[model samples]
Target: MCDILVPLTANAQRIGTEEERKLLDQSIQLCQRLLIEVTLSEATKLVGRAEYEDALPGSIQALRFSLEIYGSGRSELIPCYILLAEANLGLSRFKQAEECLCNANWILIKTRDNDKKVKSILYRGFGRLYAAQGKREEALRQLANDVSPNAALTDTVC
Candidate 1:
């Protein structure tokens, strides 16, 4: 018999039924086992908003917890890095943010779905990091790569 332990978060604690609980438990088990692919995009917007509102520690914890459970291979995980990198950027941890952006870029490169969009996000993130580091040329290169703008892209700093 394979015994699996899936750590549940506060968000996973509010289901109102046994069946839902069972399903969530199973899903958590699969996540811990790395048998299910969890995408970072599913939760990033909420987390990012939380960060923007100065609720970053919790948001970062949620993302980091998810990353630990999901094993970080999915394309959706790219946004997790990006969001966390942004948080780090806020903290003036530029090197850490740069590393996170690099990882996001690698994930974007390997992703098959919405490559253009993913590349654009990665480019924008890199641009932000480069801008922070005073590398204007590098920042411009990345900004130029971001041609197809999404409605979500409001801040030009990124």
Candidate 2:
């Protein structure tokens, strides 16, 4: 992927015709999306392997690229935020995890996104965060919402 992106990025820095510039811009965007996906996959693998320290930087990079590509309020950011929250939770950084979850919740609210799968992931992240903090009741509530069909339409945020 870097092989493709490196040349495109270098070419992007040079002056070009209007049509060429548009094509270059499109190619860059596509490459960025690929990079984001690959980074997220690697970070997720690291998190799964309980390598939170290793995952943190990649998660942050994915989040940064996602924010740049999709903007702050888009639903696309939810997964990035959730991954970051999960990594932070794994590292026992409760405050940072909560902040990331809250940012994701804010994006969901701002965008009015009602995707059940997305909400489930967000809820699960919160549930894990609360559990890590020893907030059993809060964790259970979030976990319940994660599995409850009716909870998908509700405006629940941590």
Candidate 3:
């Protein structure tokens, strides 16, 4: 959604669940045309709307498309894995989130691209996950590892 279309989500969501579902279904279908870029863009917009559960289907689709376009071992898959992890976290699916994060970690290790931004995101996500699970101390530890410059509010895992 563009800046001009930002109000569309908020306005339509107030109509009704069935109506929202119908519109979202159509949007998801449209996202399948280009597969990767458009789909991921929509998935990100869904996340921005705090529609994590709604984002999951598109996020999963984006992941498959990313793997198809960039292969499993490429750094490009990191964003897809992290996006799924974020959605899983939003849905309170801790195990699935952790699995997705672990896959991302494996990609980083395999590629030896343990880049700072990636580490920050991984740890930040770990922090969120641990907090969700009622492990404040562990969450703090994970957060401590998330010490990257301008990482706190500047960007996201995806």
Q: 144 in model 3: Cα distance from truth in Å?
A: 0.6
TM-scores, each model vs. reference: 0.59, 0.86, 0.69
Give one digit per residue, the lDDT tens place, for model 3 in 8-104.
3234543558888888756744543356666677888887888998988878877875665567888888888888899899889999998998889
lDDT of 3: 0.75
RMSD of each: 9.1, 2.5, 12.1
Candidate 2 has a TM-score of 0.86
Better of 1 and 3 by TM-score: 3
User: How displaced is residue 127 in candidate 1, in Å?
Assistant: 0.8
Structure candidate 3, residue pairs in collision: none
Model 1, position 125: C-alpha lDDT score = 79
Please name the candidate that would achieve the greatest lDDT relative to the true structure. 2
**What local lDDT does model 1 show for residue 112?**
45
Best by the TM-score measure: 2
* CA-RMSD of model 2: 2.5
How many clashing residue pairs appear in each of the predictions shown? 1, 0, 0
Between candidates 1 and 3, the lDDT winner: 3
| Candidate that beats the other on TM-score, 2 or 3, i.e. the better one | 2
C-alpha lDDT values of all predictions: 0.61, 0.83, 0.75
**Worst lDDT 10-window in candidate 2:** 5-14
